[model samples]
Target: MAETEGKFDFAIDRGGTFTDVFARLPDGRERVLKLLSRDPQNYKDAPTEGIRRVLEEESGRLFPRDQPVDTALIGWIRMGTTVATNALLEREGERTALLVSASQCYPPLPFPCCWPCNNERISVGLRSHKGRKEYDLQRH
Candidate 1:
């Protein structure tokens, strides 16, 4: 493994049951880690703990679990989580709705305007100023 020269880049996925981390060091080396998402006994956050562990191995130093990790060594971090999906499935979060409008003649709207991701609670509506409604959502 080549020694660290610059900052490290990390991509993380935090799921309901587990958190997975993928790191790319300055030397173009990659590392991965997976841990329980809710392990409060040993660590407060799984993603942070996973990053700390990777950094320790990359820098060959023991980072105190209580102390914050050195942000200077991190170039960037991209994270994704399933919290929204979990919340929607469990009906635990605040409801949100979005309304969008656009012209239909100038730049025609795509056919099948409704997205496949739409569910009973989500919808897409289209209305033209020409007094013609292309897609009208009926809320139940």
Candidate 2:
């Protein structure tokens, strides 16, 4: 095993059955580690343990129990998930909301539209709105 001191970049993928890690050490050496996913009776630590094991292998020392891994030398770490894909495949993720345009109702208005008197229930799309706001909302 070659040892170097500087910075490192790593990527980790945590899947349902395994965890894979790829790291680039300071000495320009590439390291790879794969571990089985595990969830004990009360703790889910597969991803974390996998990273730790990889780091230990690269550093040649067991990480301290009280302190976190030195992240300063870590250039970047990216994470991803297949939860949405799995949800779609399994027919899950049903929590969703639909936005109804006020103009889509009965008669279409040509000018600025006025929403019905539902002061207590109004959702503002912040993504579509911006700038300072100074106005009073009243149900009319």
Q: Count the clashes in each prediction.
A: 0, 0
Per-model C-alpha lDDT, please? 0.76, 0.58
Judged by whole-model lDDT over C-alpha atoms, candidate 2 comes out at 0.58
TM-score attained by model 2:
0.53
| Candidate 1 pairs with clashing backbones | none
lDDT of 2 by residue, 94-128 (tens): 43332335545346432233344332455443232
Q: List residue ranges in candidate 2 displaced over 4 A.
A: 1-5, 41-43, 65-67, 93-140
Scored by lDDT, the top model is 1
Query: Which candidate has the top score in TM-score?
Result: 1
Task: List candidate 1 segments past 4 Å from native.
Answer: 1-5, 94-140
Query: On residues 50-119, what C-alpha lDDT tens digit does candidate 1 reach at each position?
Result: 9999999889988888999998888888999998768766767654433333332335433333233323
* RMSD over all Cα atoms, model 2: 12.1
- Extract clashing residue pairs from model 2: none
Q: What TM-score would every model get versus the actual structure?
A: 0.63, 0.53
